[model samples]
Target chain A: MSFPYSEKVMEYFSHPKNVGEIEDADAVATEGSPACGDMVKLYLKINPETKSIEDIKFKSYGCASNIATASIITELSKNKTIEEAKKLTWKKASETLGGLPPAKVHCAVLAVDALRTAIENYEHKMGLLKEKKSTDTNIIEKRLKRVINPLTGLEVLKVNFVKKIDLDDGIITITVNLDSDHPFANNIREEIVERLEPLWDIKKVYVIFNDENERH
Target chain B: MEKRNVYLDNNATTRTDERVVEHMNHYHLNDYAVASSQFSHTPGIKAKDGIEKARQIIAEKISALNNEIVFTSGSAESNNLALKGIALANRAAKRNRIVVSKIEHFSVLDSAKRLGKEGYDIAFVDVDGEGFIDIDHLKNLVNDETLLVSIIHGNHEIGTVQDLHSISEIVHKKGAYFHTDATYSFLQIPVDVKKYGIDLMTVSSDKIHGPKGVGALYVSEDVIIEKITDGGFQEFNLRGGTENVSGIAGFGKACEIFSEEDVERIKYLRNDLYEQFKSGLKGVQLNGSSDFSRRIPNNLNLSFDYIEGESVVLHLDMRGISVITGSACFSRALQASHILLAMGFSHERAHGSIRFSPSKYTLKEDIDYTVHHVKEVVTKLRKLSPLVEQQ
Candidate 1:
């Protein structure tokens, strides 16, 4: 496949802006995923007065797209406020580059992730950052769902509803439905029984609607 | 940047030389004729002469008799013929057992594994961290039931040379036949069948700049081989099929090139490249032994921590420079190398391994260009790595 790298991407990589070390840099962030086989170490110099980025530099160990993404991100953040750079997403980096291979879209994501991670490090060190955002808050709770577990090779019926998690209460009840002759009814019953025993008191466990169990 | 592309992937396959190309072209265009023609015509005479020249050069390179070297498709075929052919002939069904090393190329390993499933017991001797075979472990494994011992000459990945003489002595002590897959080490490292007491040897042409799809097996004059297939009379009534004449011609030229440069000059270039690369990249760890005396100079396998080999290889590829992750045969698979795993490398570190092999044609400028690009790409990639935390 012909990888058409953007001219600016190549320009920054070949003659990178702020390529070397910053002696008095505000923060340095380094992170790598052993699974992905790439690493990013970001160095930033922020103006103490304006809380804006005076310089940004990065060194990356990965593919062509990864190197290009990092180079462009550093160049884009120079002279920009921390909030502006924090707002820059992977989408912005992808659009800046002509495009990347589907497998390599992660390279752009990593570049932005590294920038945000570095900024987070800077904010935490300065004692100005609040608690980091939790990823689960935006998740919409659905009623119930069934899916296959790729790792365990088992069918699991998952309920997305949140019950009152009463640890002090003696007993807790969870309602689920099995109206038809579901093949994995017994399997799901066993799975749920195995999961709930340790956390909650179960004086009597009963399957209210399991026509599938009776038919089988 | 210069437009000239470098090919250091000779271990994958050597480029067909100009002289060999001319010889093949001349035979195909003007002097082409079937070698099976008994009556000597002008075309037949040229074909016969070409085949003889190839055989003679190959024999001389390995110090074997002219009749001992039988041409086959390649090392895979040669190994199959050597191991299976010997086992089927001498070993009883219940007594079938083959001894091999863990670091052997798949041509030997898979061939043994296939036979093992057919009620043949297979014993794989392990290698140390430096890619050296544990002779004592091999000795403990070999017994009277052992049909053959197949050890590779030089490791294709780490480039550590095996002590064939010692290994051959151990197998013979146990009254078992010895075989060495000298595919990667034939021309680069010295080999002597008489000195090592090798009963059977397998080698390929492409590893030494010859045409692909042509190889030879050195079966001892006294050793017996069972026919693996039935066909017309070819390869001394053992492997029966029409021979590849052009590939054989190319193979001969490649052997002659090796004989001409018997003391290889590429070792110095390889060392220079190794030193330059080692000093340029900080936090780089050499995979095998640092002793040049024990390893092949042309092959430098290194691990750059916190970076995946595939990514490093891609960065180098983008710069128009070529290298390898390990053996080219297993390049497509993104798993830890089995050899490295057997030698006790964790999966994470093993996946980060890369091999740098240079041929006689690789220049100083090539190494310089590689070092420059490697530093840049590694520094950049390290930033993105979550495992390699900023200190």
Candidate 2:
């Protein structure tokens, strides 16, 4: 049977680059969860003087697309300034690998998330990050944009599943336009909670379904 | 020489036997008339004879009467027919409940779900860790109001073989018709429908090295089942369609060509492959029954720790070995195998599960090659896995 992978994806997956831990790393961050069947941990050793990434490595516990995406993202960010690496997008990483399957585009997102989080960690350590305000709707929406609908391979917000977002007394309630019985409903909800729960000021995160489409 | 391709996914589908193919060529080329035309022309008579001969062979294999076998497209249709047909026929008989195991093929499970949507009380019986149906739970669920209790004889993924005799006994005691999807166990294990007290059995030819698109459902003569498909009278009026004469002939030829010796040899290879993995790898767990006799002879499912199964599957594919994984990443639904999850495995365990099913055509060299490449792939992936601790 034919595999649903591009030749570049297979090439990187079969022989992935930067597949290890950076033992005395400047910054490290992990994204995704084992329960979701995809996780990537990125390690960066940045040059403090020039603010450039001296070396970058990654370890993945996921499928070929996850490994391939992580490999491509590390290749794209090595030796670049931390600011430049932070500017790298998941779409660019996936495009460099000749584009992933629609179902696997989320792996690219996870890779980019891990890389940016590691850069953020480095910035926080160097006191380069600004004093952040308390969590707000815009920050919640920015994080929610990372939550992908598995069926559509796009952000839940972009797919118009986020019907409403309400933040009150540190409690975030997001209403999605899907029934609980939809095949990917639980996945979307779990991802939303996973994304919003880690905010510094968030107290509780609740995801409610609109039950508007229960065809599944 | 080019690297040899080793296929260990026989549980998915087998390579059709050459002898069966040669036998089918005659019906496809010469006697290409529909069996319904038996009263019309000479070729039609030959086609009818060919189909009847196939029916007789399949019936004899399961120790059923020739008239009891109804041909369907394959096991999925057979399962759909058995569940929906019995539910429809017994709609007015005061039995509105259907009980099935949680680990049944989607054909059985989804059909029962459809029946539930139509107002039938559907109950899913649980399975133990080894994928065996819980006997006491089944007994509790299947009562007088239950029209059918459908379970799989041999689980397709994990390879656990259920005790049909005791299951049938329980269902019969409750006055419920017992149906089994024996697609994986039809030829691999001996099944006597009469001895097991099975009312309906679904068997597919493709799993037994026969041509695809042909399967038979054995319905006991006393069971009442309505036709789900409406068409011209065919398959004893229980199923309506033009017969697949060539595929049926090929299926019969496959059954005739099946030898017990091949099963014994494939079992040996399967066991040897597992033994090699146990000796060569660390943190490898067997997912199915520990008892060899209770599992499908040609099936072995293993979960390698730390590393995900899809990576191993792709790496093995690069080395020309074919296998399947239960990882959510590998499925379009983005969910792990329901069978493994229903067995109470963690998502990590389910993501690491791999199924290797060797057929009679698999060789010792193939097993050795697979084990070696699998070890290399697992070791490499484990090093790159965030779940694995750095030493």
Candidate 3:
């Protein structure tokens, strides 16, 4: 009867809030190490003019402590201004959840990292714009990085976020960086292709990962 | 809170059987005495008799001579005695190597590691995915310089039983003594010291519903073991401590509870439940052997993909069913099951492993309830899992 979790942590785990992806989020970030077997993808729809978190959601693949921390983070950060959300610490998030077990504090740390990352992405995107002008090819890399390949746990830069970054007159060709014997090599390629294919008016978005000839 | 309790964690420990309890209570109430003071008083004489009778019962169970059994604290201590005691006792010019299998319990592994630092060369033989030792590889490792080869009789995580008959033979052929930690597999399967030709073995009392503090190490006549602890002239001067009179009495009583028919009944129920879980759930893979004859009767280790094993354990606990996981997060070091990893399981699959062990007292309805709960828990957890649908 003495579970290590608080009632609040268990509640959030059993019935997580704001789950799943936001198909076209203004900012997105993934946190946690796949090697540790805990990962979180935080997708946020921001109020552009107000610079506030509007709608928030999460997709977490981890233990109960991890999922609960992710769910609680979304609940505590939604509708907050960027400054306020970034100020939130892992300690505060754990206290808000009534407290996690001593061994599970890393889960809270991951939640805060994801939130801070999302806001930073928003700020970076906002910096490039007067407002809402994301038709740039470089913006494509940021968006594709949002798709956290479960295995590598790396985003755009580590896993072929644009291996060469070539931009022709209209064609924007990008290659995915994948491991040779990766089990989800196909899904990673498809996700990158699916995300970039709908951006701007690019004539073509070619998908490639772990290209053998290029892998010297 | 009002729901019925379901305890299927017999491999970890079990409720002390009522018969064992009665013997323990009797000895605790009346027979408590200094067994070494047998020349002094009546209580001392009675205590000495109780210790001897208990020793005789354990000796008969394993078909070993009464003098060959040295009672220690538990299987962990017995392993220490068998490995280190033998090593220190036989610390000679030539014999200075140790070999243990990868799938041995932590006690055997840790003890062998301790010997390694003291100048003994240590090597581990690999196991197949099902946890069977690679026999040819083992044969190649053991040489005349090899001091002792210790392996588990049955893996506590995967329930894969190592064939002591062949393993002991290999060690003996190389002139190295063999020790098997039979803590988990002792009474659950058929064990005979002579039939397997084991030079040494460790058996636990608590594992068979006896008292926890009493365990015995079966050291053959030829193996000279040095004292791990010293003081008194007890346990043939090898283990120097006063006997745990009540626990030893209970240990002997627990030894008489097992029969071939009882083991068959346990196997039938374990196999039946394994079938139910496999048939009822998707991606529900049994970790060890499916063939009933190859593994222990009351043990089943299974893994469900796309989720962590700790969550399943918590979910089952919430429903009043007790279980354990082999995942590293659940382990002492927060490391995943070395057994599963050594058997070639991916880290993800290793974290997803669960061990279900039921004693002879487990009812059919208890098994059914556990299975139904496991299916429900796995489905619910999958819905919360991020990796299940992504890949």
Candidate 4:
């Protein structure tokens, strides 16, 4: 287990700082699907003057990987401009944490996704983007309807598979309730992304399978 | 600091006793002949003597006749044989039905499920909150059409021991056969199939510190139970295979060595550990019967809410303490303890359940260390849990 992750990942996990919520933060974003059992919520206080992230913190509901990555991402984003923070990829998050297991690499992906979501929310709230309602939720819903889940063989909609769908600042986050019994979740995610690919206003698309792992 | 091994999963499998190993080795090296061999060679007679001796001891321990004990691979196969073999034999009787408790082990449950394909109407009896069998429900389920009523003597995960005498009476009133799986309770508790009115019973050697790959099914005299395998006329033409003479010898040695006093001492240790665990821990709820006499003396199952049981088990494992969890994440069970769920526990409680079964070899120090490490693990995981933060 020690070699599965670097000392840095374990360190952040054991002594995770900025581990609470920002009560009245300017921007907030919760990411990760409940189906896979890992979730992270990012809270931010963006200084309007410099358009930089003045304060950042997180609340994570996952294993050591999720907690450490969320803690590291928050620390890495603090004091950085909104645009600069938005540029940080999941790879950079893992690189900063020394390294992460390939399977657990999603923990870092979730961290950066949460950060970008917060940034997107911040820009929309600041009136940088006008009212942000171009995302017709039904288009994604209709696209999801036609998809017959590869494993269950039933239509995804028939099983009540859609867990969550959040639209904020033209950024769409679709959380599908994919149990371990469900197959080809990647294909479902890909189909959803492809269906939304034509929409220019939707800057970012997140199709997450169940994020929660151990306990719901 | 690294911790030494503290194995508390004795119900899963006990460490083979040294005497059992020695007895097995004796048969393997010196008396390595087919037990059923008719040739009058000394080695062949020795093998045959070993098998017969082991069978007599096992039968005596359970208060059965020597010829009644039919040897099989282990309890699972014995369970299948007792259920499917009996069902197959009695299908001509036109009863075409079976009754089993919801808390019966998967071996019995799965066997009954397989029997369902053969047109046997399988009825699951309910259990109370403490995992006790509901007698009224059992009375309602048993009728003229019921061919066999199989109930486990003790629950494995929750450690709930059912009263076989009472259950046997109810099944007998309806003229149906009563089968009890005594795999967990036979050696740890005083299980007398005749005294309890049990028509058939399943017992495992490995669960009682004996060699693996050996078990027995006590078929009451004149039950006329059918055999699944068709081979040489061994095991009185019931279990048709060459006997595992070495393993059976080892099993007999284990049974003889495990005395009545051993039961009392193990029960004392179990209660002592339970007292400390209940007093030492917070938000820890015991899963099975509160009465120690009504549960397996070697088992203590507990649940801690908010945090997953798998987390606690894994953390303890990292500290060199082996245990099992009812958590869906750790088990073949897609979610929570089915035993707990049957007893009407919330999904969270089932997800947070852990079963710790200590043997006679489990030292008081090992129990103390286990409790200390368990508290530490639960506290840490609760802190890390998002569900806790949400609360």
Indicate which candidate wins on TM-score: 3
Q: Residue-wise lDDT of candidate 3 within B144-228, one digit each (tens)?
A: 8998999999888788898999999999998999999999898777689988999899999988888888899999997888989
**Order of all candidates by TM-score, from best down to worst?**
3, 2, 4, 1
DockQ, ranked from best to worst: 2, 3, 1, 4
True contacts kept of each: 0.31, 0.71, 0.25, 0.12
TM-scores for all candidates: the values are 0.69, 0.87, 0.88, 0.77
lDDT of 3 by residue, A69-169 (tens): 99989988899988889888999889988898887888899889888877765665567323554446567767665566444344556664447655565
Off by over 4 Å in 2: A132-216
- For candidate 4, the per-residue lDDT at B365 reads 79
Q: How close is candidate 4 to the true structure, as a TM-score?
A: 0.77
- Report lDDT (Cα) of residue B224, candidate 2: 80
Top-lDDT structure, candidate number: 2
Candidate 3, superposed: residue stretches over 4 Å from native: A1-3, A33-35, A121-216
lDDT of each: 0.69, 0.88, 0.80, 0.80
Judge candidate 1 at residue B99 and give its lDDT. 92
Model 1 TM-score (B-chain only): 0.94
What's the CA RMSD for each of the models? 12.7, 7.9, 4.4, 8.4
Model 2, residue A167: distance off in Å is 22
